[model samples]
Target: MGDDASLTARKAQLRKECLAARDGVGPLRRAMAGTRLYARLMGLRGRTIAGYLPIGSEANPTHAMRVLARDNRICVPVVTARGAPLRFREWWPDCPLEKGAFGVPVPTEGGWRVPDVLILPMVGFDAGGGRLGYGGGYYDRTLAGMGDALAVGFALEAQRVEAIPQERTDITLPYIITDAGVFGADGTV
Candidate 1:
Protein backbone atom coordinates (compact mmCIF):
# COMPACT_ATOMS: atom_id res chain seq x y z
CA MET A 1 0.00 0.00 0.00
CA GLY A 2 2.82 2.40 0.94
CA ASP A 3 4.76 1.69 -2.25
CA ASP A 4 1.71 2.23 -4.45
CA ALA A 5 0.92 5.50 -2.69
CA SER A 6 4.51 6.74 -3.04
CA LEU A 7 4.65 5.93 -6.73
CA THR A 8 1.38 7.71 -7.37
CA ALA A 9 2.59 10.79 -5.49
CA ARG A 10 5.90 10.79 -7.39
CA LYS A 11 4.12 10.61 -10.74
CA ALA A 12 1.88 13.50 -9.75
CA GLN A 13 4.85 15.65 -8.76
CA LEU A 14 6.63 14.87 -12.03
CA ARG A 15 3.54 15.76 -14.02
CA LYS A 16 3.37 19.17 -12.34
CA GLU A 17 7.05 19.84 -12.95
CA CYS A 18 6.85 18.77 -16.58
CA LEU A 19 3.85 20.99 -17.27
CA ALA A 20 5.72 23.91 -15.74
CA ALA A 21 8.74 23.27 -17.94
CA ARG A 22 6.55 23.17 -21.04
CA ASP A 23 4.68 26.31 -20.01
CA GLY A 24 7.94 28.17 -19.41
CA VAL A 25 8.89 27.89 -23.07
CA GLY A 26 8.23 31.09 -25.05
CA PRO A 27 5.54 31.14 -27.74
CA LEU A 28 7.92 32.10 -30.53
CA ARG A 29 10.20 29.24 -29.63
CA ARG A 30 7.25 26.91 -29.52
CA ALA A 31 6.14 28.00 -32.99
CA MET A 32 9.64 27.53 -34.32
CA ALA A 33 9.65 24.05 -32.91
CA GLY A 34 6.41 23.34 -34.70
CA THR A 35 7.91 24.56 -37.96
CA ARG A 36 10.82 22.22 -37.60
CA LEU A 37 8.48 19.40 -36.78
CA TYR A 38 6.59 20.09 -39.99
CA ALA A 39 9.77 19.97 -42.02
CA ARG A 40 10.76 16.62 -40.61
CA LEU A 41 7.39 15.06 -41.30
CA MET A 42 6.57 16.75 -44.58
CA GLY A 43 8.14 13.94 -46.55
CA LEU A 44 5.75 11.39 -45.12
CA ARG A 45 3.15 10.14 -47.53
CA GLY A 46 0.37 7.62 -48.03
CA ARG A 47 0.10 6.55 -44.42
CA THR A 48 -2.84 7.40 -42.20
CA ILE A 49 -1.70 9.71 -39.42
CA ALA A 50 -3.20 10.33 -36.02
CA GLY A 51 -2.13 13.83 -35.03
CA TYR A 52 -3.29 16.17 -32.31
CA LEU A 53 -4.35 19.75 -31.75
CA PRO A 54 -2.18 21.45 -29.20
CA ILE A 55 -3.70 22.28 -25.85
CA GLY A 56 -2.10 24.97 -23.75
CA SER A 57 1.68 24.41 -23.68
CA GLU A 58 1.68 21.17 -25.65
CA ALA A 59 4.01 21.23 -28.65
CA ASN A 60 1.84 21.75 -31.68
CA PRO A 61 1.83 19.17 -34.47
CA THR A 62 -0.84 20.84 -36.61
CA HIS A 63 1.70 22.19 -39.08
CA ALA A 64 2.80 18.71 -39.96
CA MET A 65 -0.72 17.43 -39.84
CA ARG A 66 -1.80 19.94 -42.44
CA VAL A 67 0.99 19.18 -44.86
CA LEU A 68 0.57 15.45 -44.49
CA ALA A 69 -3.08 15.79 -45.32
CA ARG A 70 -2.10 16.60 -48.90
CA ASP A 71 -1.03 13.02 -49.60
CA ASN A 72 -2.17 11.19 -46.50
CA ARG A 73 -5.20 10.94 -44.31
CA ILE A 74 -4.92 12.96 -41.12
CA CYS A 75 -7.01 12.48 -38.02
CA VAL A 76 -7.25 13.87 -34.50
CA PRO A 77 -8.05 11.99 -31.34
CA VAL A 78 -11.42 12.33 -29.65
CA VAL A 79 -11.99 11.70 -25.97
CA THR A 80 -15.21 9.74 -25.85
CA ALA A 81 -15.16 8.77 -22.20
CA ARG A 82 -13.08 8.94 -19.07
CA GLY A 83 -11.40 5.53 -19.33
CA ALA A 84 -12.10 4.60 -22.92
CA PRO A 85 -9.32 4.63 -25.51
CA LEU A 86 -9.52 7.75 -27.64
CA ARG A 87 -11.25 7.53 -31.00
CA PHE A 88 -9.64 9.08 -34.07
CA ARG A 89 -11.77 11.29 -36.28
CA GLU A 90 -10.82 12.30 -39.79
CA TRP A 91 -9.50 15.86 -40.13
CA TRP A 92 -8.41 18.12 -42.95
CA PRO A 93 -7.57 21.71 -43.58
CA ASP A 94 -10.63 23.81 -42.71
CA CYS A 95 -12.44 20.79 -41.38
CA PRO A 96 -15.30 21.78 -39.14
CA LEU A 97 -14.12 21.55 -35.55
CA GLU A 98 -15.84 22.07 -32.24
CA LYS A 99 -14.26 22.07 -28.83
CA GLY A 100 -14.34 18.61 -27.36
CA ALA A 101 -13.17 17.40 -23.97
CA PHE A 102 -10.74 19.78 -22.22
CA GLY A 103 -11.41 22.36 -24.95
CA VAL A 104 -9.30 20.51 -27.51
CA PRO A 105 -10.84 20.86 -30.92
CA VAL A 106 -12.37 17.89 -32.73
CA PRO A 107 -14.14 17.40 -36.01
CA THR A 108 -17.75 18.51 -35.87
CA GLU A 109 -18.66 15.28 -37.62
CA GLY A 110 -16.35 12.82 -39.36
CA GLY A 111 -15.81 9.15 -39.91
CA TRP A 112 -13.70 7.31 -37.37
CA ARG A 113 -10.37 5.88 -38.49
CA VAL A 114 -7.36 4.07 -37.11
CA PRO A 115 -3.96 5.48 -37.89
CA ASP A 116 -0.80 3.76 -39.03
CA VAL A 117 1.23 6.29 -37.10
CA LEU A 118 0.46 8.38 -34.04
CA ILE A 119 2.13 11.74 -33.45
CA LEU A 120 1.63 12.33 -29.77
CA PRO A 121 2.18 15.65 -28.06
CA MET A 122 3.99 15.31 -24.79
CA VAL A 123 4.46 17.47 -21.71
CA GLY A 124 7.90 15.96 -21.21
CA PHE A 125 10.02 13.17 -22.71
CA ASP A 126 13.21 11.37 -21.85
CA ALA A 127 15.90 10.29 -24.32
CA GLY A 128 14.63 6.79 -24.05
CA GLY A 129 11.30 7.92 -25.53
CA GLY A 130 9.48 7.81 -22.23
CA ARG A 131 6.63 10.30 -22.46
CA LEU A 132 4.93 12.17 -19.65
CA GLY A 133 1.51 13.23 -20.81
CA TYR A 134 -1.23 15.18 -19.02
CA GLY A 135 -1.96 12.10 -16.85
CA GLY A 136 -5.13 11.17 -18.64
CA GLY A 137 -3.71 7.84 -19.84
CA TYR A 138 -5.57 8.29 -23.10
CA TYR A 139 -2.51 7.70 -25.24
CA ASP A 140 -1.45 4.77 -23.13
CA ARG A 141 -4.79 3.10 -23.55
CA THR A 142 -4.92 3.97 -27.22
CA LEU A 143 -1.45 2.60 -27.83
CA ALA A 144 -2.16 -0.61 -25.98
CA GLY A 145 -4.80 -1.51 -28.54
CA MET A 146 -2.68 -0.37 -31.47
CA GLY A 147 0.51 -2.18 -30.62
CA ASP A 148 1.68 -2.42 -34.21
CA ALA A 149 1.26 1.25 -34.95
CA LEU A 150 4.36 3.36 -34.61
CA ALA A 151 4.07 5.88 -31.76
CA VAL A 152 6.16 8.99 -32.13
CA GLY A 153 6.20 11.70 -29.51
CA PHE A 154 6.46 15.40 -30.34
CA ALA A 155 7.87 17.94 -27.89
CA LEU A 156 10.35 20.78 -27.56
CA GLU A 157 13.77 20.03 -26.22
CA ALA A 158 12.99 22.24 -23.26
CA GLN A 159 10.51 19.58 -22.18
CA ARG A 160 13.25 16.98 -22.10
CA VAL A 161 13.72 15.28 -18.76
CA GLU A 162 16.39 12.89 -17.52
CA ALA A 163 13.72 10.30 -16.85
CA ILE A 164 9.98 9.92 -16.57
CA PRO A 165 8.48 8.17 -13.55
CA GLN A 166 6.33 5.44 -15.12
CA GLU A 167 3.64 2.94 -14.15
CA ARG A 168 3.09 -0.55 -15.53
CA THR A 169 0.41 0.72 -17.91
CA ASP A 170 2.68 3.45 -19.25
CA ILE A 171 3.83 3.11 -22.86
CA THR A 172 7.30 3.96 -24.17
CA LEU A 173 7.47 5.66 -27.52
CA PRO A 174 10.26 4.29 -29.74
CA TYR A 175 10.67 7.57 -31.56
CA ILE A 176 10.49 11.16 -30.35
CA ILE A 177 10.74 14.26 -32.55
CA THR A 178 12.12 17.24 -30.65
CA ASP A 179 13.04 20.79 -31.58
CA ALA A 180 16.67 19.71 -31.57
CA GLY A 181 16.29 16.44 -33.49
CA VAL A 182 14.72 13.02 -33.53
CA PHE A 183 15.40 10.51 -30.79
CA GLY A 184 15.24 6.92 -31.96
CA ALA A 185 15.73 3.55 -30.36
CA ASP A 186 19.48 3.63 -31.10
CA GLY A 187 20.07 7.36 -30.53
CA THR A 188 19.30 10.81 -31.85
CA VAL A 189 19.01 10.90 -35.62
Candidate 2:
Protein backbone atom coordinates (compact mmCIF):
# COMPACT_ATOMS: atom_id res chain seq x y z
CA MET A 1 0.00 0.00 0.00
CA GLY A 2 1.15 3.56 -0.61
CA ASP A 3 1.87 5.74 2.43
CA ASP A 4 -1.48 7.50 2.29
CA ALA A 5 -3.38 4.24 1.85
CA SER A 6 -1.56 2.60 4.75
CA LEU A 7 -2.34 5.54 6.95
CA THR A 8 -5.98 5.41 5.96
CA ALA A 9 -6.25 1.74 6.84
CA ARG A 10 -4.61 2.29 10.19
CA LYS A 11 -6.96 5.13 11.00
CA ALA A 12 -9.98 3.09 9.94
CA GLN A 13 -9.08 0.29 12.33
CA LEU A 14 -8.42 2.70 15.18
CA ARG A 15 -11.63 4.55 14.57
CA LYS A 16 -13.62 1.33 14.85
CA GLU A 17 -11.92 0.37 18.07
CA CYS A 18 -12.33 3.80 19.60
CA LEU A 19 -16.00 4.07 18.72
CA ALA A 20 -16.75 0.71 20.31
CA ALA A 21 -15.08 1.80 23.47
CA ARG A 22 -17.15 4.96 23.52
CA ASP A 23 -20.32 2.97 23.08
CA GLY A 24 -19.37 0.55 25.82
CA VAL A 25 -19.65 3.24 28.46
CA GLY A 26 -22.76 2.32 30.41
CA PRO A 27 -25.60 4.78 31.04
CA LEU A 28 -24.25 5.56 34.49
CA ARG A 29 -20.88 6.42 33.08
CA ARG A 30 -22.38 8.32 30.21
CA ALA A 31 -24.40 10.43 32.60
CA MET A 32 -21.33 11.06 34.70
CA ALA A 33 -19.46 12.07 31.62
CA GLY A 34 -22.19 14.42 30.64
CA THR A 35 -22.09 16.05 34.04
CA ARG A 36 -18.33 16.46 33.93
CA LEU A 37 -18.43 17.93 30.46
CA TYR A 38 -21.10 20.41 31.48
CA ALA A 39 -18.96 21.59 34.36
CA ARG A 40 -15.83 21.86 32.22
CA LEU A 41 -17.60 23.77 29.48
CA MET A 42 -19.08 26.30 31.88
CA GLY A 43 -15.78 28.15 31.86
CA LEU A 44 -16.40 29.36 28.35
CA ARG A 45 -18.71 32.32 28.43
CA GLY A 46 -19.92 35.31 26.44
CA ARG A 47 -18.83 33.87 23.10
CA THR A 48 -20.63 32.61 20.08
CA ILE A 49 -20.25 28.87 20.47
CA ALA A 50 -21.31 25.98 18.29
CA GLY A 51 -22.47 22.84 20.04
CA TYR A 52 -23.68 19.78 18.18
CA LEU A 53 -26.72 17.66 18.84
CA PRO A 54 -25.59 14.28 20.11
CA ILE A 55 -26.03 11.40 17.70
CA GLY A 56 -25.74 7.80 18.90
CA SER A 57 -23.11 7.46 21.60
CA GLU A 58 -21.63 10.90 21.06
CA ALA A 59 -21.35 12.96 24.24
CA ASN A 60 -24.19 15.46 24.48
CA PRO A 61 -23.48 19.16 24.95
CA THR A 62 -27.06 20.24 25.48
CA HIS A 63 -26.58 21.17 29.10
CA ALA A 64 -23.77 23.57 28.38
CA MET A 65 -25.52 25.01 25.37
CA ARG A 66 -28.63 25.75 27.36
CA VAL A 67 -26.83 27.51 30.18
CA LEU A 68 -24.52 29.36 27.86
CA ALA A 69 -27.37 30.58 25.74
CA ARG A 70 -28.49 32.84 28.56
CA ASP A 71 -25.19 34.73 28.35
CA ASN A 72 -23.76 33.84 24.95
CA ARG A 73 -24.87 33.15 21.45
CA ILE A 74 -25.25 29.45 20.80
CA CYS A 75 -25.38 27.80 17.38
CA VAL A 76 -25.33 24.37 15.83
CA PRO A 77 -23.56 23.08 12.75
CA VAL A 78 -25.55 22.69 9.56
CA VAL A 79 -24.14 20.62 6.74
CA THR A 80 -25.27 22.66 3.78
CA ALA A 81 -23.49 20.59 1.16
CA ARG A 82 -21.34 17.54 0.84
CA GLY A 83 -17.61 18.31 0.93
CA ALA A 84 -18.27 21.83 2.05
CA PRO A 85 -17.27 23.45 5.33
CA LEU A 86 -20.15 23.32 7.80
CA ARG A 87 -22.32 26.37 8.38
CA PHE A 88 -23.38 27.55 11.85
CA ARG A 89 -27.01 28.39 12.48
CA GLU A 90 -28.46 30.00 15.56
CA TRP A 91 -29.78 27.41 18.03
CA TRP A 92 -31.77 27.32 21.25
CA PRO A 93 -32.92 24.71 23.70
CA ASP A 94 -36.29 24.53 22.01
CA CYS A 95 -35.48 25.49 18.47
CA PRO A 96 -37.55 23.69 15.88
CA LEU A 97 -35.31 21.09 14.28
CA GLU A 98 -35.42 18.85 11.26
CA LYS A 99 -33.01 16.14 10.29
CA GLY A 100 -30.51 17.63 7.93
CA ALA A 101 -27.65 16.01 6.01
CA PHE A 102 -26.48 12.74 7.59
CA GLY A 103 -29.69 12.67 9.63
CA VAL A 104 -28.22 15.06 12.17
CA PRO A 105 -30.70 17.46 13.71
CA VAL A 106 -30.41 21.06 12.53
CA PRO A 107 -32.32 24.21 13.21
CA THR A 108 -35.27 24.57 10.89
CA GLU A 109 -35.16 28.37 10.83
CA GLY A 110 -32.26 30.47 12.03
CA GLY A 111 -29.83 33.00 10.66
CA TRP A 112 -26.29 31.91 9.93
CA ARG A 113 -23.48 33.06 12.17
CA VAL A 114 -19.78 32.43 12.80
CA PRO A 115 -18.94 30.97 16.19
CA ASP A 116 -15.81 31.77 18.12
CA VAL A 117 -15.80 28.35 19.73
CA LEU A 118 -16.75 25.03 18.18
CA ILE A 119 -17.45 21.99 20.34
CA LEU A 120 -16.61 19.09 18.02
CA PRO A 121 -17.28 15.44 18.64
CA MET A 122 -14.22 13.21 18.50
CA VAL A 123 -14.19 9.59 17.41
CA GLY A 124 -10.64 9.27 18.72
CA PHE A 125 -7.77 11.45 19.83
CA ASP A 126 -4.18 11.44 21.07
CA ALA A 127 -2.50 13.44 23.82
CA GLY A 128 -0.69 15.63 21.33
CA GLY A 129 -4.05 17.18 20.36
CA GLY A 130 -4.45 14.97 17.29
CA ARG A 131 -8.14 14.60 16.47
CA LEU A 132 -9.53 11.58 14.63
CA GLY A 133 -13.02 12.23 13.41
CA TYR A 134 -15.38 10.24 11.23
CA GLY A 135 -13.88 9.82 7.74
CA GLY A 136 -15.87 12.69 6.19
CA GLY A 137 -13.41 15.41 7.32
CA TYR A 138 -16.16 17.99 7.86
CA TYR A 139 -14.71 19.33 11.08
CA ASP A 140 -11.24 19.49 9.58
CA ARG A 141 -12.45 21.55 6.65
CA THR A 142 -14.62 23.73 8.89
CA LEU A 143 -11.87 24.38 11.37
CA ALA A 144 -9.42 25.28 8.63
CA GLY A 145 -11.71 28.01 7.41
CA MET A 146 -12.69 29.22 10.91
CA GLY A 147 -9.97 31.71 11.70
CA ASP A 148 -9.34 31.94 15.48
CA ALA A 149 -12.23 29.71 16.44
CA LEU A 150 -11.19 27.58 19.39
CA ALA A 151 -11.82 23.92 18.58
CA VAL A 152 -12.69 21.77 21.59
CA GLY A 153 -13.18 18.02 21.40
CA PHE A 154 -16.12 16.64 23.39
CA ALA A 155 -15.97 12.91 24.11
CA LEU A 156 -15.82 10.24 26.75
CA GLU A 157 -12.38 9.44 28.13
CA ALA A 158 -12.72 6.05 26.46
CA GLN A 159 -12.18 7.74 23.11
CA ARG A 160 -8.56 8.60 23.84
CA VAL A 161 -6.06 6.39 22.03
CA GLU A 162 -2.31 6.07 22.24
CA ALA A 163 -1.97 7.91 18.98
CA ILE A 164 -4.08 9.17 16.13
CA PRO A 165 -2.77 8.62 12.63
CA GLN A 166 -1.98 12.03 11.25
CA GLU A 167 -2.66 13.50 7.81
CA ARG A 168 -1.87 16.97 6.54
CA THR A 169 -5.48 18.06 6.87
CA ASP A 170 -5.97 16.96 10.46
CA ILE A 171 -6.44 19.92 12.80
CA THR A 172 -5.15 19.80 16.40
CA LEU A 173 -7.66 20.55 19.13
CA PRO A 174 -6.78 23.16 21.73
CA TYR A 175 -8.82 21.42 24.40
CA ILE A 176 -10.48 18.03 24.75
CA ILE A 177 -12.94 17.89 27.65
CA THR A 178 -13.63 14.24 28.27
CA ASP A 179 -15.45 12.52 31.13
CA ALA A 180 -12.24 12.09 33.06
CA GLY A 181 -10.99 15.67 32.91
CA VAL A 182 -10.13 18.58 30.70
CA PHE A 183 -7.09 17.98 28.49
CA GLY A 184 -5.04 20.88 27.30
CA ALA A 185 -3.50 21.24 23.85
CA ASP A 186 -0.51 19.14 24.97
CA GLY A 187 -2.93 16.40 26.08
CA THR A 188 -2.19 17.05 29.72
CA VAL A 189 -4.94 17.73 32.26
**Steric clash count of candidate 2:** 0
Q: Quote the positional error of residue 108 for candidate 1 in Å.
A: 0.7
**Highest lDDT against the true fold, candidate:** 2
Candidate 1's C-alpha runs over 4 A off are: none
lDDT of 1: 0.86
lDDT of 1 by residue, 84-119 (tens): 999999999889999999999999977999999899
Worst 10 residues of 2 by lDDT: 28-37
lDDT of the candidates, in the order given: 0.86, 0.88
C-alpha TM-scores of all predictions:
0.93, 0.95
- Candidate 1: 10-residue stretch with minimal lDDT: 179-188
Error of 1 at 55 (Å): 0.9
Off by over 4 Å in 2: none
Model 2 residue 81 CA deviation in Å? 1.1
